[model samples]
Target: MSHVGVTLGVMAAIPALVEPTMLRWARQTQGYSVLAAARKIGIDEDKLAACEAGYERLTIEQLRKAAKAYRRSLAVFFLDTPPEGIDTLRDFRRVAGSESGEWSPELHTEFRRAQQQRDWLIDLLESEDTPVPTAWSLPSSEVARLSDAQLASRIRSHLEGLAGSSGPTTSDRYAHSSFWVSTLEDSGVLVLHTSGGGVATQEMRAMSLYFDRVPVIVLNGSDAVRARTFSLVHEYVHLLLHADGLCDMVTTTRATNPNTALEARCNAVAAEVLMPAAAVRAATESLRGRPVDEWTYERIASAAVRFGTSAEALLLRLVNLGLASRSLYEQRREDFQRAYVEQERSAATGGDFYRTKARDIGKGYVRRVAGAHRRKVIDSFTAATYLDVKVGQITRLAEAAGFASASGR
Candidate 1:
């Protein structure tokens, strides 16, 4: 062999010297099968099996690849044992038959990301001796006791600033969801929208993490803006109940199923919050005597526009209020579902980096981290890490959050 070729072969033969159980633990915790993990690391399945079994060793390059695939730091593999982390979220997605613990690796990543963010928020608040938001003053037991309408009324009163003098805002759909997110954040809830490389809409519409201090809600940004508006409120309700779960929000309201019941309660609360019964009645008063058939698709879409919610959601509300028949809702909802299925998948928009980052991690979080940095509570590198941006971009991120650049500090 040539001198360079021999050197390369020698380098490739070097072992990573990580524990075999660590490799296996990382793969299993990440929900990756041996074959899938091998494919992700660009190695053969048998080789991965051997490495995990301690029968063989992987090169440092291969170990790095495995680390990337498993979303772990390379140094973690050298630890005495795998880190102990449990799946704290209760799965509420309605699978066809038996419960399958299998979840997409993306979901596992999101779960960890949410937990890390929550922990960061806790630490930040503790450093400042800040009390938890008053929005959570209403305990979960009291929240559970109140009927949906009562809870909805309370929420409306609490967030009435969003409605202004007229009523629900106009058809500026994106602004609608943004407004809710911002308001929730002000109420001491950290709201995050999943950016590119996040979980798909089908796998999860949204999830909530309940904490007494600073609760968190994550929305699947891939869904339609209107859909996300509903999901935001739905997850908000989940927080009110202090129930944290990985949710699909499939709109299955049957009470017989326990998971469905919880989802139904959240859905019902969301409906009342967004489409107050009194407002819905006023909107449909013009057609009081008309048959349910008169509620055409175009009309439903028009009405949904005012509330910045999906026509399907609006229709379901009508059925619940007895303003429309169940049969009519089912038929129209089927059409809406079909249209949703046919809708083109929204590709990630490439644009100015600062605005996108601001939207992803949330303006409230950005402002807080920026304020902390400005006060010398966290350094530039720490601020950048919290905001998921480069240190160079910290100035722009603060600006995006409407704060002056504090990178000079």
Candidate 2:
């Protein structure tokens, strides 16, 4: 049958049954909230929730509304064959709170879809003999139970062993940002740039075990460069604990409360992971009364350059170590941001590379699908859909990885 006819038929057969799944799918695939979906569909929030939970039936109007809302063809909703990689997508849906109703329909859906697509791409790349893993399946939950102090001790011990006389001297230069960023993605952290969102807003959302794959992290696209890095570290902590849900680290002006106990713990873990207190103290001592109170932006910038970190990071480290006051830190932050603005303007770029590069290179999602395809877990068409591209594009990826050309075919 035609794709449209198939979709309509699917809607007719299990219109009510698909409502919850569709609502959940819309949210994850497109980041639409339940309230928003209700508004779009002209249904009351409770009714919409009920509809999504499969407690109520959806009218033909509702089915059309949902199909449009989710940007999916009606046929997609009712394919006789589960779309080639439905399992991963379904797993993502399940893990991302599709069944429990924990997340706002939009966020839950977008994250799951993005993760599924990413995994599919990674799987495909692996089929072409790419060395990348399908996912970074870490045992985060086992480590998350440790206290902040215990985590700190563990990080210090790990660093001490990792840091040898011949190793890189700067605390800031441990590894290239790209290396860690890719590593985080491989570990099932769904990092993406928010096309639209507020400032100082980024999160390490909770893990979901949809389809039995490991948990995933979702970072906002709207955060500043420094904020994004912090978000990555924050989410890494969440992954370690095998926990899920949002951990918003943005400090607001409106006197918000501290994070939840678990979030606070994760924060502590993130700070320790990125900047060890002992390392900071030792680094500070090495400067030996360098008169941090009067240190200029140039001085801080120079130090950051030497340490392979941003000036903002160095200032924060000083504040955490009690070598700089809050007021001083704030002033330095303003100066650094101002300087950054001037430099970025001179460069005349559209956005920060770190913020948008992964999506641009298709590194975030494409690689995962490639990996999955290589593992024979999914077929080529499935890889194409997950990457949101055509089968030909998948072929190009294969060719790029040195596979025999399929161009003549």
- lDDT against the true structure, each candidate: 0.79, 0.53
Candidate 1's TM-score reads 0.86
Q: What is the TM-score of each candidate against the true structure?
A: 0.86, 0.59
Best candidate per TM-score, number?
1
**For candidate 2, lDDT tens digit of each residue in 1-409?**
9999999777665644453565566545555677887887777888878876778877766767777776566666544333453323211112232222234434544554555555654455555666543244434564657677677556434433433212133434324334345555554444554434422232233233322243455556544444455566666665555554454553222322333555556566666665666666666564536776557766665555433456667776677667777787776777886875564356455744322433433354544555566666788787666655577677555444323332232
RMSD of model 1, in Å? 3.9
Candidate 1 per-residue lDDT, tens place, 89-189, comes to 78887655533246788887877777777788778878888786746436667787899889987776777654342235687776777677778888888
Clashing pairs in 1: none
Off by over 4 Å in 1: 1-19, 59-61, 79-82, 96-101, 132-134, 161-167, 338-352, 404-409
- Identify the runs in model 2 with alpha carbons over 4 angstroms from their true place: 1-62, 71-109, 118-175, 185-213, 251-258, 278-293, 305-309, 334-365, 371-378, 395-409
Span of 10 residues, lowest total lDDT, candidate 1: 340-349
lDDT leader: 1
